[model samples]
Target: MPLAVYLLGLAIFVQGTSEFMLSGLLPDIAADLGVTIPEAGLLTSAFALGMVIGGPPLAVATLRWSRRRALVWFLAVFAAVHVVGALTTSYELLLVTRVVSAVANAGFWAVAAATAIGMVAPDAKARAMSVVVGGITVACVAGVPGGAVLGQLWGWRSAFWAVAVLSVLTLAFLVRVPAGRGQAATGLRGELRVLANRRLWVAFATIALAEAAMFGVFTYLAPLATGTAGLPASWVPGLLVLFGAGSVLGITVGGRIADARPYQTLFAGLTALTLACAALAVLADSGPALIALVFLIGLLGFGINPAMSSRAFYLGAAAPTLVGASVTSAFNVGNMLGPWLGGVTIGAGLGFGSVAWIGAALAAAAIATVALALTLRGRQPVPAQARA
Candidate 1:
């Protein structure tokens, strides 16, 4: 815990807020643009697509910059996107702004994890990364709900304006973060060099599958809770707070588990999450049971994030920067794919309950991928604490 860690948390908070606030603002955007609710959801898709496409390439390209300069520059870019997003009136212009925002997001996250790890002692890496990612959970607890309120009161556009202001503040404080050189990813060639490892692909598969499961259900969660659970639309906000609570618990518990044995923890988390997702989807009819299972899914599903990320870090020892970029890229790809796939299922007449099934399937796939990685390594088992 250096003072810089707090800045890292704040930076992530701003990023997470900008990224997730769209869910609550969709109706306002849809009304303004005269699009269907489903179509308006593309705002999220646009941002995620930008992140997926930009993350690794940006990481590879910016590998030459010092970490502090890179972070400040990226945050500056991130802030500008939000500013444009706040000001734009044309829906098409808004989409372009979101893409710009996505580019900043992609680069910021890739560097943020690497920067956070580099900031701390080797043993403290997991804790530091967890603290940084706390911003995402904070968004769940505060950002989404706050944005909803902001959108309702001042208009949806005001939420973007609010985010723009916060982004500028984050950039101002980021001056306090320590500067350092990031590993040069060289370019696409450098990135491909790391991808040369088959094991790395296994790790990527695991990351993608795990996120696919989590986001598929989560992206459609508001509708599912309302339609399937027989709950009021207004209750969606309160329920999301509960989801955030579970996520906070899961991330902390999982971060500790990762310190013990990152890959082993991934194995267990994936398996447990798969079960929880399956149970939730199958039992959505029961009010009490649905709440309990949704919470369980949130708890188990999110617990794997740090471990899977660390696994990428270890497996890509030869190319830490590329690995960092690739992990984030994989994460975003899953984010995009998850919602699109879930939306497709629903459009094809599948019930909201299928969200959990999609999640369960992805989790099971992730577990199998990681288990295979463990078998191939053939590393002699060490005691859990020693692994940490």
Candidate 2:
């Protein structure tokens, strides 16, 4: 892998830390800003909404720009918004900043993924994606926790300041990234034509469903651990750490093999994920079982990510940057849908274990989707460029 790929991963790490650290800072932010906790939580939702909607438009807007320029511009915007978010006392201003920052983050992600794939051979695409995704997995393990600790020791604003500084540092390193090659030669209309491909949409559906399966259970893990599994509150953090650790391992292993065997990788990982969720549903009363299942779920769930991501690039080969945007949008859709569905089950008085069951159902659906994608992919003629 190129050094530039690792640098792109570093950039993702900084942005991802900002994306996730808000979960830890919401309480402090609510108190300081004189809003309800739920209201403060909307900041997180706003960011998600921005990510879901922001990517494609930004990708098109910057479609003609050099990858290096697009990335640096997005990073600068990300950093500036965080600085404003850190200094702002008005809740509304802070909310606006979060949305702006998320837009910038989305743009950066699209450009970076396209750039990473551009730097690598077609056979190594998944491995390159793993390096990029690894940054965010590491963020989940280290950056989120570190930000929480920073918030507990100082004010929550301190966490925002820290993100701003990290973004600046990442921006400095991004100067080394090459001005990417093989941009879509056909202008906007030709690039947009790629979206008409049925296989590409199947790939998108598979990714969204897989992520929904993962996050449905994950969003409710704290309650599942403490209430159903009988673990103490302190153990919740440790369980989260364990899950993150498992994710790191999953992504590492998945990256190495996904390019060589995309369909097999997706099937195996999603099937194991479904089984893991079912096991969690059945064994939630046993603390040890719950702990083990959490790690296993994390491993199996994230293990398929490289294949999921690389599929988009492979199928959407004609429009790499726009496809990157679609990948981001698909992921955020899953992120939102999973938690909302889980919340519905909980609100309907289904036990916490219901989320695990929900996860299982979603994973099963994802497996079915993968089968459909494979069947469709087999029927479609492979592009000559892709064969090379």
Candidate 3:
């Protein structure tokens, strides 16, 4: 593995920790700020919304800088935002801070793995990208659990402070990595043209739909557990650990699947996702059933991420960075929509089971997107659709 991959992993760790810690700390935040849990959850939505709005504009605006400098400047902005987030007391102020932090975050994801892939040898690209993305799974497996523990031990705000410190470490490590081959603005403009292709939209749709369903329930999982899963509040953390473990497996293995039979794995994963969501919706009446359902959902849902990512990589070989960031933006789009829909359903007195219905619908949409991608890719007559 290149040093760049390690640095990307670390950056992702802090970034993931910074973004994801909201769920673990929400209860504490609610208590401290005198707000309902649902209202407090806007912190997560605010971040997701930031990523959705910021991913492209920032990437396009920073096109003049080398990928390395762009990443550094992004990390710098990200670190400052975390500091601001830690200091803010008013709920509205914190919301604004989270939006700023998420902008930096959107830029980081847009460039980091794509930059790392450029740094290493060609044969090493897939492995390097996997290692870079692995940080997200690692965050779920460890960083988040640790943050949750810290929240339990001290306060929710401390976790953000911890992420801020980690950001510094990530920045220092990232500084040492070579910039690799720099991308030009022409390449970005070329990427914009590529984006207009119908197949690319299909691929983006596939990613967005899958993410929305997966995260929708995940956002409100703690409550989902209490409502339908029947798991005790104490058991939620451990269950999350299990989900993290499965996610680690998914991320590591997803790459291999992409290398082997990309389309097959994708279709299978989407199909399984639909079935899993349907099954969970039907079975989400009690503790043990919900536990089994949630685990199955996590295992199956996260298992295809690498496959989906790689599919986009191959399909969008024209403009890697733009497509890469666009896929991530699609991810946050799902992130924003899923929870909002879930919250609406829950607020409407629809139980946790309603989440599965949404999940199933999204899964169906994802499969349709994949079908469209495969169809368009197979029929693409022009050898050079755009540029890489």
Candidate 4:
């Protein structure tokens, strides 16, 4: 992999660590901020809201800038926001910081693929992207668990501080990126025109609902581990390690085959996800079963990422960057919706395991959506550009 690609991965690690660490810190944050657990959980939703709300506009606004410049600017903002987040004692201020950090995070992810594509050989684009995405999986494997450990040892704020430090180092590594790519501004109307395709919206909905199934169960994992599975609090990090390991394998394999069999990957992944969720719902109390199911859940949940993304781009080839931004927005919408739905289940006295059952339903729904899209696809002809 190119040095720039590795640096981009490191940047993603910084941003993703901050984004995911909130799950591990929920209890501590709830006590420190004097908020209910549900209220603290909304912090995840708020960050996703920022990503959903900010991603596309940021992509369009910075369309003409060098990808490297846009990336650096966003990372700088992200790092600074973490500093504010770490120091803030007020819950509202922390919430505001999460939103700001997510806006920056959204912009970074919106441009990341485009930047990676620009940096490497054409044939290497997918490989390069996998490397960048691997950073996220690696973060799940290490950074998040590490953050949890830090929170357990020092305080929740220390996780934010560590992410800030990582961001600074990533910024230093990014000095190698070029300042000029001669990228011209795309017309807003032209980009918006891509949204008119029925198939593209189908793909977006598929991504949203598929991810909703995963996050719905995942957001409450700490409680599930403690309350439902009867695992010790200290065991959470190890479970994350297993999940992240599964994710790494999933994404790596997905990246290799996604170009040729995008839909197959999507179908298979969602099917696996559905089964995993259902299994978790029934067997969560069994220690060994929970551990095995958690890994399978991670594997299936993230396995199709490359295929899902490539499918979206294929459907929206007319506006690649906008497609990227739109998909990022869609993923965060699922991220927000998942936790919100999970929280609703708990509030309604459905118990923690119900979260997994609901997730299974959502994944099944996504499978149906995929089947419908496939049916429509068989009836309709592929666009020549999309075929290319």
> Where in model 2 is the C-alpha error above 4 Å?
181-184
lDDT of 3: 0.78
Q: Relative to the unseen true structure, what is the C-alpha lDDT of residue 61 in candidate 1, on a scale of 0 to 100?
A: 78
Clashing pairs in 2: none
TM-score of 3: 0.93
Task: List model 1 lDDT by residue over 1-388, tens digit each.
Answer: 6778768878888888888888889989989878889777777878888888887788887878887888888888887877777787778888888888888887888887777776776666666767777778888888888998999999998898888889888888878888867666455565577577777788888888988998888877777877888877887887788888788788778877686678777877888889888887888766677677667767776788777777776656555566777887898889877777887888888889888888888889888898888876776442232244
- Of 2 and 4, the candidate ranking higher by TM-score: 2
* Local accuracy of candidate 2 as per-residue lDDT tens digits, 161-250: 999999998888988999874354768998888888888888889888889899888878889999998989888778878888989999
> Which regions of candidate 1 deviate over 4 angstroms?
184-191, 379-388
Error of 4 at 237 (Å): 2.1
Give me the runs in candidate 3 sitting further than 4 Å from their true place.
120-126, 185-188, 382-388
Task: Rank candidates, lDDT, best first.
Answer: 2, 4, 1, 3
Candidate 2 Cα deviation (angstroms), residue 263: 0.6
Candidate 3 per-residue lDDT, tens place, 1-388, comes to 7676787887887888777878789989888878889789888878888989888888777766778888888888888877887777778887888988998888888888577666655444556666777888788878999998888887887887888888887788877777754457456667687677777777778888998888887776787787677778998888787777877776677655665676787889889889888887887777777777677777767777777765666556666677767878988888887777887887798887898888888988999888887778779853352223
Please state the error at residue 101 of candidate 2 in Å. Answer: 1.0
Judge candidate 2 at residue 370 and give its lDDT: 89
TM for candidate 2 is 0.98
lDDT of 4 by residue, 224-321 (tens): 89999999988877888888999899888877877667778888889989999999999878888889988888888888777776677777766666
Candidates' TM-scores?
0.93, 0.98, 0.93, 0.92
